[model samples]
Target: MLHTVNKSPFDSHSLQTCLGLAKAGSDILLIEDAVYAAMSGTAVTSMVESAMNSSTIYALEPDLKARGIGSEKMISGINLVGYDGFVELAVTNDKVQSWL
Candidate 1:
Protein backbone atom coordinates (compact mmCIF):
# COMPACT_ATOMS: atom_id res chain seq x y z
CA MET A 1 0.00 0.00 0.00
CA LEU A 2 1.05 3.59 -0.61
CA HIS A 3 -0.24 6.94 0.51
CA THR A 4 0.46 10.51 -0.55
CA VAL A 5 -0.06 13.16 2.09
CA ASN A 6 -0.72 16.47 0.40
CA LYS A 7 -2.49 18.25 3.25
CA SER A 8 -1.85 18.65 6.96
CA PRO A 9 -4.67 16.72 8.60
CA PHE A 10 -4.39 13.96 6.07
CA ASP A 11 -0.65 14.04 6.45
CA SER A 12 -1.00 13.33 10.13
CA HIS A 13 -3.94 10.97 9.95
CA SER A 14 -2.82 8.96 6.98
CA LEU A 15 0.57 8.41 8.55
CA GLN A 16 -1.11 7.13 11.67
CA THR A 17 -3.11 4.79 9.51
CA CYS A 18 -0.03 3.46 7.78
CA LEU A 19 1.59 2.81 11.13
CA GLY A 20 -1.18 0.46 12.16
CA LEU A 21 -1.14 -1.47 8.91
CA ALA A 22 2.63 -1.72 8.93
CA LYS A 23 2.66 -3.45 5.59
CA ALA A 24 5.96 -4.85 4.45
CA GLY A 25 6.16 -2.35 1.59
CA SER A 26 3.91 0.47 2.61
CA ASP A 27 4.98 3.96 1.50
CA ILE A 28 4.18 7.52 2.37
CA LEU A 29 5.01 10.37 0.05
CA LEU A 30 5.39 13.87 1.40
CA ILE A 31 4.96 16.35 -1.38
CA GLU A 32 4.12 20.03 -1.83
CA ASP A 33 4.00 21.72 1.58
CA ALA A 34 4.05 18.26 3.01
CA VAL A 35 7.78 18.29 2.42
CA TYR A 36 8.12 20.75 5.26
CA ALA A 37 6.77 18.04 7.54
CA ALA A 38 10.26 16.50 7.48
CA MET A 39 11.78 18.85 10.04
CA SER A 40 13.36 16.81 12.82
CA GLY A 41 11.34 15.77 15.86
CA THR A 42 7.83 16.72 14.89
CA ALA A 43 4.64 14.74 14.49
CA VAL A 44 5.44 14.37 10.84
CA THR A 45 8.99 13.39 11.66
CA SER A 46 7.80 10.64 13.96
CA MET A 47 5.41 9.52 11.31
CA VAL A 48 8.23 9.49 8.79
CA GLU A 49 10.22 7.24 11.05
CA SER A 50 7.32 4.92 11.70
CA ALA A 51 6.53 4.45 8.05
CA MET A 52 10.13 4.18 6.93
CA ASN A 53 11.07 1.70 9.64
CA SER A 54 8.41 -0.61 8.32
CA SER A 55 8.40 0.31 4.64
CA THR A 56 9.59 2.73 1.96
CA ILE A 57 9.10 6.46 2.24
CA TYR A 58 10.14 9.33 -0.01
CA ALA A 59 9.89 13.06 -0.48
CA LEU A 60 9.44 14.89 -3.71
CA GLU A 61 12.80 16.60 -4.18
CA PRO A 62 11.63 19.42 -6.37
CA ASP A 63 8.92 20.35 -3.88
CA LEU A 64 11.35 20.32 -0.98
CA LYS A 65 13.88 22.50 -2.79
CA ALA A 66 11.21 24.81 -4.12
CA ARG A 67 10.23 25.39 -0.48
CA GLY A 68 13.87 26.05 0.53
CA ILE A 69 14.45 22.65 2.13
CA GLY A 70 17.82 21.44 0.94
CA SER A 71 18.34 17.77 0.26
CA GLU A 72 21.02 17.49 2.96
CA LYS A 73 18.64 18.35 5.80
CA MET A 74 16.03 15.78 4.89
CA ILE A 75 14.89 13.43 7.63
CA SER A 76 16.56 10.04 7.77
CA GLY A 77 14.79 7.26 5.81
CA ILE A 78 13.17 9.89 3.67
CA ASN A 79 14.90 9.68 0.32
CA LEU A 80 14.65 12.50 -2.18
CA VAL A 81 13.10 11.03 -5.28
CA GLY A 82 12.68 12.88 -8.53
CA TYR A 83 9.72 12.71 -10.88
CA ASP A 84 10.93 9.43 -12.26
CA GLY A 85 10.83 7.81 -8.86
CA PHE A 86 7.36 9.12 -8.25
CA VAL A 87 6.25 7.67 -11.53
CA GLU A 88 7.90 4.42 -10.64
CA LEU A 89 6.06 4.23 -7.36
CA ALA A 90 2.80 4.80 -9.13
CA VAL A 91 3.52 2.03 -11.54
CA THR A 92 4.90 -0.44 -9.03
CA ASN A 93 2.61 -0.17 -6.03
CA ASP A 94 -0.36 -2.49 -5.67
CA LYS A 95 -2.44 0.38 -4.40
CA VAL A 96 -2.06 4.17 -4.13
CA GLN A 97 -4.14 6.43 -1.97
CA SER A 98 -4.03 10.21 -1.99
CA TRP A 99 -4.59 12.06 1.25
CA LEU A 100 -5.61 15.56 0.33
Candidate 2:
Protein backbone atom coordinates (compact mmCIF):
# COMPACT_ATOMS: atom_id res chain seq x y z
CA MET A 1 0.00 0.00 0.00
CA LEU A 2 1.02 3.59 -0.53
CA HIS A 3 0.02 6.39 1.81
CA THR A 4 0.33 10.00 0.71
CA VAL A 5 0.27 12.86 3.20
CA ASN A 6 0.03 16.46 2.09
CA LYS A 7 -0.48 18.27 5.37
CA SER A 8 2.17 19.76 7.58
CA PRO A 9 2.74 17.83 10.79
CA PHE A 10 2.93 21.11 12.65
CA ASP A 11 -0.46 22.15 11.40
CA SER A 12 -2.31 18.87 11.21
CA HIS A 13 -2.39 15.42 12.67
CA SER A 14 -2.93 13.76 9.29
CA LEU A 15 0.67 12.64 8.99
CA GLN A 16 0.72 11.21 12.48
CA THR A 17 -2.58 9.46 11.93
CA CYS A 18 -1.38 8.04 8.64
CA LEU A 19 1.79 6.83 10.24
CA GLY A 20 -0.12 5.11 13.00
CA LEU A 21 -2.37 3.30 10.56
CA ALA A 22 0.03 2.52 7.73
CA LYS A 23 0.96 -1.16 7.76
CA ALA A 24 4.45 -2.51 7.84
CA GLY A 25 6.20 -2.57 4.46
CA SER A 26 3.81 0.05 3.15
CA ASP A 27 5.09 3.08 1.27
CA ILE A 28 4.58 6.53 2.76
CA LEU A 29 4.99 9.54 0.51
CA LEU A 30 5.25 13.01 2.00
CA ILE A 31 4.08 15.64 -0.45
CA GLU A 32 3.20 19.34 -0.39
CA ASP A 33 3.63 20.90 3.02
CA ALA A 34 3.92 17.43 4.48
CA VAL A 35 7.47 17.42 3.22
CA TYR A 36 8.30 19.36 6.38
CA ALA A 37 7.99 16.17 8.35
CA ALA A 38 10.75 14.55 6.34
CA MET A 39 13.36 16.97 7.57
CA SER A 40 15.72 16.25 10.39
CA GLY A 41 15.44 17.74 13.93
CA THR A 42 11.75 18.53 13.71
CA ALA A 43 9.20 17.49 16.32
CA VAL A 44 8.05 14.73 14.04
CA THR A 45 11.47 13.59 12.95
CA SER A 46 11.74 10.82 15.51
CA MET A 47 8.29 9.60 14.67
CA VAL A 48 9.02 9.58 10.98
CA GLU A 49 12.34 7.91 11.59
CA SER A 50 10.73 5.22 13.72
CA ALA A 51 8.12 4.59 11.07
CA MET A 52 10.94 3.91 8.61
CA ASN A 53 11.74 0.80 10.56
CA SER A 54 8.57 -0.79 9.20
CA SER A 55 7.84 1.27 6.12
CA THR A 56 9.58 3.03 3.26
CA ILE A 57 9.27 6.82 3.67
CA TYR A 58 9.55 9.13 0.69
CA ALA A 59 9.28 12.86 0.17
CA LEU A 60 8.46 14.58 -3.10
CA GLU A 61 11.60 16.38 -4.24
CA PRO A 62 9.84 19.24 -5.96
CA ASP A 63 7.76 19.98 -2.91
CA LEU A 64 10.82 20.03 -0.73
CA LYS A 65 12.57 22.38 -3.09
CA ALA A 66 9.57 24.67 -3.19
CA ARG A 67 9.70 24.81 0.58
CA GLY A 68 13.42 25.63 0.45
CA ILE A 69 14.43 22.31 1.91
CA GLY A 70 17.61 20.85 0.54
CA SER A 71 18.67 17.22 0.68
CA GLU A 72 21.05 18.07 3.49
CA LYS A 73 18.09 19.14 5.62
CA MET A 74 16.24 15.88 5.06
CA ILE A 75 16.49 12.98 7.43
CA SER A 76 18.80 10.17 6.37
CA GLY A 77 17.14 7.12 4.75
CA ILE A 78 14.14 9.13 3.63
CA ASN A 79 13.98 8.78 -0.13
CA LEU A 80 13.40 11.85 -2.30
CA VAL A 81 11.34 11.34 -5.44
CA GLY A 82 10.32 13.38 -8.40
CA TYR A 83 6.89 13.46 -10.05
CA ASP A 84 7.87 10.50 -12.20
CA GLY A 85 9.00 8.59 -9.18
CA PHE A 86 5.72 9.44 -7.47
CA VAL A 87 3.90 8.03 -10.48
CA GLU A 88 6.00 4.91 -10.36
CA LEU A 89 5.23 4.42 -6.70
CA ALA A 90 1.51 4.86 -7.25
CA VAL A 91 1.64 2.42 -10.12
CA THR A 92 3.72 -0.09 -8.21
CA ASN A 93 1.61 -0.06 -5.08
CA ASP A 94 -1.68 -1.91 -5.08
CA LYS A 95 -3.45 0.88 -3.19
CA VAL A 96 -2.99 4.56 -2.36
CA GLN A 97 -4.44 6.33 0.66
CA SER A 98 -4.26 10.09 0.79
CA TRP A 99 -4.22 11.75 4.18
CA LEU A 100 -5.41 15.29 3.80
Candidate 3:
Protein backbone atom coordinates (compact mmCIF):
# COMPACT_ATOMS: atom_id res chain seq x y z
CA MET A 1 0.00 0.00 0.00
CA LEU A 2 1.27 3.45 -0.99
CA HIS A 3 -0.52 5.57 1.58
CA THR A 4 -0.46 9.18 0.46
CA VAL A 5 -2.62 10.90 3.02
CA ASN A 6 -1.20 13.72 5.22
CA LYS A 7 -3.89 14.64 7.70
CA SER A 8 -4.56 12.94 11.03
CA PRO A 9 -8.02 11.72 10.01
CA PHE A 10 -6.59 10.22 6.89
CA ASP A 11 -3.60 8.84 8.80
CA SER A 12 -5.89 7.12 11.33
CA HIS A 13 -7.79 5.23 8.67
CA SER A 14 -4.80 4.67 6.45
CA LEU A 15 -2.71 3.42 9.33
CA GLN A 16 -5.50 1.06 10.33
CA THR A 17 -5.79 -0.24 6.79
CA CYS A 18 -2.06 -0.88 6.63
CA LEU A 19 -2.18 -2.66 9.96
CA GLY A 20 -5.07 -4.83 8.78
CA LEU A 21 -3.12 -5.90 5.73
CA ALA A 22 0.03 -6.39 7.80
CA LYS A 23 -1.79 -8.54 10.35
CA ALA A 24 -2.70 -10.73 7.41
CA GLY A 25 1.02 -10.92 6.55
CA SER A 26 1.07 -8.11 4.05
CA ASP A 27 3.52 -5.18 3.77
CA ILE A 28 2.96 -1.43 3.44
CA LEU A 29 4.74 1.21 1.36
CA LEU A 30 3.81 4.67 2.50
CA ILE A 31 4.28 7.56 0.09
CA GLU A 32 3.94 11.37 -0.03
CA ASP A 33 2.86 12.87 3.25
CA ALA A 34 2.11 9.54 4.82
CA VAL A 35 5.73 9.42 5.94
CA TYR A 36 4.79 11.37 9.04
CA ALA A 37 3.71 8.08 10.56
CA ALA A 38 7.39 7.22 10.80
CA MET A 39 7.86 9.99 13.31
CA SER A 40 7.96 9.29 17.02
CA GLY A 41 4.94 9.89 19.29
CA THR A 42 2.41 10.62 16.56
CA ALA A 43 -0.88 8.75 16.36
CA VAL A 44 0.26 7.16 13.16
CA THR A 45 3.57 6.25 14.79
CA SER A 46 1.92 3.82 17.15
CA MET A 47 -0.16 2.50 14.30
CA VAL A 48 2.95 1.90 12.21
CA GLU A 49 4.59 0.21 15.14
CA SER A 50 1.65 -2.13 15.54
CA ALA A 51 1.75 -2.95 11.87
CA MET A 52 5.52 -3.50 11.98
CA ASN A 53 5.14 -5.75 14.94
CA SER A 54 3.46 -8.11 12.51
CA SER A 55 4.64 -7.28 8.98
CA THR A 56 7.03 -5.19 6.89
CA ILE A 57 6.43 -1.45 6.60
CA TYR A 58 8.32 1.21 4.62
CA ALA A 59 8.13 4.90 4.02
CA LEU A 60 9.18 6.71 0.86
CA GLU A 61 12.43 8.56 1.53
CA PRO A 62 11.62 11.58 -0.61
CA ASP A 63 8.35 11.97 1.16
CA LEU A 64 9.88 11.75 4.59
CA LYS A 65 12.50 14.38 3.92
CA ALA A 66 10.16 16.57 1.93
CA ARG A 67 7.93 16.88 4.97
CA GLY A 68 10.95 17.30 7.28
CA ILE A 69 10.77 13.89 8.92
CA GLY A 70 14.28 12.59 8.39
CA SER A 71 15.49 9.05 8.74
CA GLU A 72 17.30 9.91 11.96
CA LYS A 73 14.01 10.97 13.48
CA MET A 74 12.02 7.96 12.32
CA ILE A 75 10.52 5.72 14.94
CA SER A 76 12.33 2.48 15.67
CA GLY A 77 10.92 0.21 12.98
CA ILE A 78 9.92 2.30 9.99
CA ASN A 79 12.19 1.60 7.06
CA LEU A 80 12.90 4.39 4.63
CA VAL A 81 13.03 3.19 1.07
CA GLY A 82 13.83 4.86 -2.21
CA TYR A 83 12.10 4.80 -5.61
CA ASP A 84 13.78 1.58 -6.59
CA GLY A 85 12.54 0.14 -3.37
CA PHE A 86 9.02 1.03 -4.41
CA VAL A 87 9.50 -0.90 -7.64
CA GLU A 88 10.82 -3.84 -5.73
CA LEU A 89 7.87 -3.93 -3.36
CA ALA A 90 5.42 -3.65 -6.26
CA VAL A 91 7.07 -6.51 -8.06
CA THR A 92 7.45 -8.61 -4.94
CA ASN A 93 4.03 -8.17 -3.41
CA ASP A 94 1.03 -10.29 -4.38
CA LYS A 95 -0.94 -7.10 -5.00
CA VAL A 96 -0.66 -3.33 -5.00
CA GLN A 97 -3.09 -0.55 -4.02
CA SER A 98 -3.09 3.17 -3.35
CA TRP A 99 -4.79 4.93 -0.49
CA LEU A 100 -5.70 8.56 -0.85
Candidate 4:
Protein backbone atom coordinates (compact mmCIF):
# COMPACT_ATOMS: atom_id res chain seq x y z
CA MET A 1 0.00 0.00 0.00
CA LEU A 2 1.33 3.37 -1.03
CA HIS A 3 -1.53 5.36 -2.49
CA THR A 4 -0.78 9.08 -2.64
CA VAL A 5 -3.06 10.93 -5.02
CA ASN A 6 -2.79 14.70 -4.70
CA LYS A 7 -6.20 15.59 -6.18
CA SER A 8 -7.41 16.86 -9.55
CA PRO A 9 -9.13 14.26 -11.48
CA PHE A 10 -10.52 17.32 -13.14
CA ASP A 11 -10.80 19.07 -9.78
CA SER A 12 -10.97 16.19 -7.37
CA HIS A 13 -13.07 13.36 -6.38
CA SER A 14 -9.77 12.62 -4.80
CA LEU A 15 -8.96 10.54 -7.79
CA GLN A 16 -12.35 8.92 -7.67
CA THR A 17 -12.12 8.28 -4.01
CA CYS A 18 -8.68 6.88 -4.35
CA LEU A 19 -9.75 4.59 -7.11
CA GLY A 20 -12.60 3.21 -5.13
CA LEU A 21 -10.62 2.34 -2.05
CA ALA A 22 -7.60 0.77 -3.66
CA LYS A 23 -6.64 -2.75 -2.62
CA ALA A 24 -5.08 -5.12 -5.05
CA GLY A 25 -1.34 -4.74 -4.90
CA SER A 26 -1.86 -1.01 -4.32
CA ASP A 27 0.98 1.43 -4.97
CA ILE A 28 -0.45 4.42 -6.83
CA LEU A 29 1.49 7.67 -6.45
CA LEU A 30 0.48 10.52 -8.80
CA ILE A 31 1.59 13.55 -6.84
CA GLU A 32 0.39 17.18 -7.03
CA ASP A 33 -2.75 17.78 -8.99
CA ALA A 34 -2.63 14.06 -9.06
CA VAL A 35 -0.48 14.41 -12.11
CA TYR A 36 -3.71 14.91 -13.94
CA ALA A 37 -4.66 11.31 -13.45
CA ALA A 38 -1.52 10.16 -15.17
CA MET A 39 -2.60 11.73 -18.43
CA SER A 40 -3.26 10.09 -21.80
CA GLY A 41 -6.73 11.28 -22.74
CA THR A 42 -8.31 12.84 -19.78
CA ALA A 43 -11.77 12.20 -18.33
CA VAL A 44 -10.00 10.00 -15.89
CA THR A 45 -8.34 8.14 -18.71
CA SER A 46 -10.42 5.06 -18.54
CA MET A 47 -10.31 5.22 -14.82
CA VAL A 48 -6.58 5.43 -14.85
CA GLU A 49 -6.45 2.61 -17.33
CA SER A 50 -8.61 0.34 -15.28
CA ALA A 51 -6.47 0.91 -12.25
CA MET A 52 -3.65 -0.60 -14.21
CA ASN A 53 -5.06 -4.06 -13.79
CA SER A 54 -4.79 -4.01 -10.04
CA SER A 55 -2.58 -1.07 -9.16
CA THR A 56 0.99 0.02 -9.65
CA ILE A 57 0.45 3.41 -11.23
CA TYR A 58 2.87 6.22 -10.46
CA ALA A 59 3.53 9.75 -11.59
CA LEU A 60 5.51 12.51 -10.04
CA GLU A 61 8.33 13.31 -12.35
CA PRO A 62 8.54 16.75 -10.97
CA ASP A 63 4.80 16.80 -10.92
CA LEU A 64 4.75 15.96 -14.56
CA LYS A 65 7.17 18.65 -15.40
CA ALA A 66 5.26 21.19 -13.40
CA ARG A 67 2.03 20.39 -15.19
CA GLY A 68 3.32 20.56 -18.70
CA ILE A 69 2.85 16.80 -18.54
CA GLY A 70 5.35 15.34 -20.90
CA SER A 71 6.46 11.71 -20.86
CA GLU A 72 4.51 11.59 -24.07
CA LYS A 73 1.43 12.60 -22.15
CA MET A 74 1.70 9.59 -19.88
CA ILE A 75 -0.56 6.58 -19.22
CA SER A 76 1.14 3.75 -20.95
CA GLY A 77 1.64 1.86 -17.78
CA ILE A 78 2.12 5.05 -15.84
CA ASN A 79 5.26 5.07 -13.51
CA LEU A 80 7.39 8.17 -13.76
CA VAL A 81 8.78 8.99 -10.38
CA GLY A 82 11.46 11.43 -9.36
CA TYR A 83 12.11 13.23 -6.09
CA ASP A 84 14.37 10.33 -5.57
CA GLY A 85 11.56 8.29 -6.93
CA PHE A 86 9.36 9.86 -4.35
CA VAL A 87 11.73 8.84 -1.67
CA GLU A 88 11.89 5.38 -3.03
CA LEU A 89 8.15 5.08 -2.95
CA ALA A 90 7.91 6.28 0.56
CA VAL A 91 10.56 3.89 1.62
CA THR A 92 9.30 0.85 -0.20
CA ASN A 93 5.68 1.22 0.77
CA ASP A 94 4.54 -0.26 3.98
CA LYS A 95 1.75 2.30 3.92
CA VAL A 96 1.44 5.89 2.68
CA GLN A 97 -2.14 6.75 1.87
CA SER A 98 -2.80 10.44 1.25
CA TRP A 99 -5.76 10.86 -1.03
CA LEU A 100 -6.62 14.42 -0.19
Each candidate: what lDDT?
A: 0.71, 0.95, 0.67, 0.86
- Worst 10-residue lDDT window, candidate 2: 38-47
Better TM-score candidate (1, 3):
3
Model 4 TM-score relative to the real fold: 0.33
Best by TM-score: 2
Cand. 3 Cα-lDDT: 0.67
Where does model 1 exceed 4 Å of error? 9-14, 18-22
Ranking by lDDT: 2, 4, 1, 3
**11-100 per-residue lDDT for model 4 (tens digits):** 768888888999988888888888888888878799889989998998988878988988787879788878898888889988788887
Q: By descending TM-score, how would the candidates be arranged? A: 2, 3, 1, 4
Winning candidate number (lDDT): 2
Q: Estimate the TM-score of every prediction.
A: 0.78, 0.98, 0.79, 0.33
Q: Which residue pairs overlap in candidate 1's backbone?
A: none
Better of 2 and 4 by lDDT: 2
Candidate 4 — which pairs collide? none
| Winner by lDDT between candidate 4 and candidate 1 | 4
